[model samples]
Target: MTNHWAHPTAIIDEGASIGEGTKVWHFSHISPKTIIGEQCSLGQNVYVASNVTIGNSVKIQNNVSVYEGVILEDFVFCGPSMVFTNVRTPRSAFPRNTSEDYRPTVVKRGASIGANATVVCGVTIGEWAFVAAGAVVNRDVPAYSLVAGVPAKGMGWVCECGSTLTFRDQKSVCHDCDREYERNQDIVRKTKDV
Candidate 1:
């Protein structure tokens, strides 16, 4: 028997791979060939389409739909009612139903998408990046960046522990987690205390 837990109302189709300790709550549907990693939580009304890949410890809140061509790495957080689009331009008359027509979206490890955010396809959300609520992400987000507003503009940098970083001469030390960070132009990276 699988070690995962799915509520009675949840539909886990055949060929879906759910890792140990994964919990799928009410009204959730996991399509065939989808792979979800260990300790993940899929909240109510979550719909994960076929062939989607979600990594360990991912938390997908209620009303979220993860379509095909979406890859969520470990520690990713998808807040309530967040949207993910696979097709760039959708026309009902001419359907782009095939996987080749879909654009792939990769959410890197530790990235957090806030509530009601919409992530457009083909963009890479960098590791430890944070997308604020209701933001529409259309472009690639740099690592450790905090992006907000429509179309998602980079507002500041954040530590791995999710605290906002204040740089002094391009260098910052997190007060919450005591981590060090350095900013070089548009890119930010964790640095060693030396």
Candidate 2:
């Protein structure tokens, strides 16, 4: 197993499982019981709480705080200063003490949450979904969907290659990869035979 790089200023708590080739940068704190997969990059001042699971090749930018009960699938991109909440309703007097009160947040494989986005608890961002910068996502995002605005709404569909899908008669084609897609009930499906 290859040795992961953790800067001296970084605090990797005991019992945290950091996979090989992962780099924990300056002043980061990885809580105990957090599982970080291989080849991931945690940028400066990142905070990963316990009970968080980060998959391989994930890129977490500076100042991002991934709270407890958040699960990120492989190749997920968390932009700078993005916030993830584990508690649906938080009050100073009424502290959530049990795991049952903490809502789980799931960011599926290859999804990209843009800079400063706020991802509320108990939502699943589907595979390859693109969340625009400064957007607030309060609901479940569909796979390959491009969402923006407050309480984010689906603006359009995106290709797996991260290109916008332009439609012609309910059939959309990816500009970059030339892949074909068919729209069914607002969901885009790959039409090309792989």
Q: How does each model score on lDDT? A: 0.97, 0.93
- Candidate closest to the true structure, highest TM-score: 1
As a whole number from 0 to 100, the lDDT of residue 13 in candidate 2 is: 92
Off by over 4 Å in 1: none
* Weakest lDDT window of 10 consecutive positions for candidate 2: 185-194
Candidate 2 per-residue C-alpha lDDT over 104-124 given as tens digits, one digit per residue, 9 for 90 to 100? 999999999999999999999
Instruction: Provide the RMSD of all predictions against the true structure, rounded to 1 decimal.
Output: 1.3, 1.5
Q: Which 10 consecutive residues of model 1 have the lowest summed lDDT?
A: 185-194
Query: Clash pairs of candidate 2?
Result: none
How many residue pairs of model 1 clash at the backbone? Answer: 0
RMSD of 1: 1.3
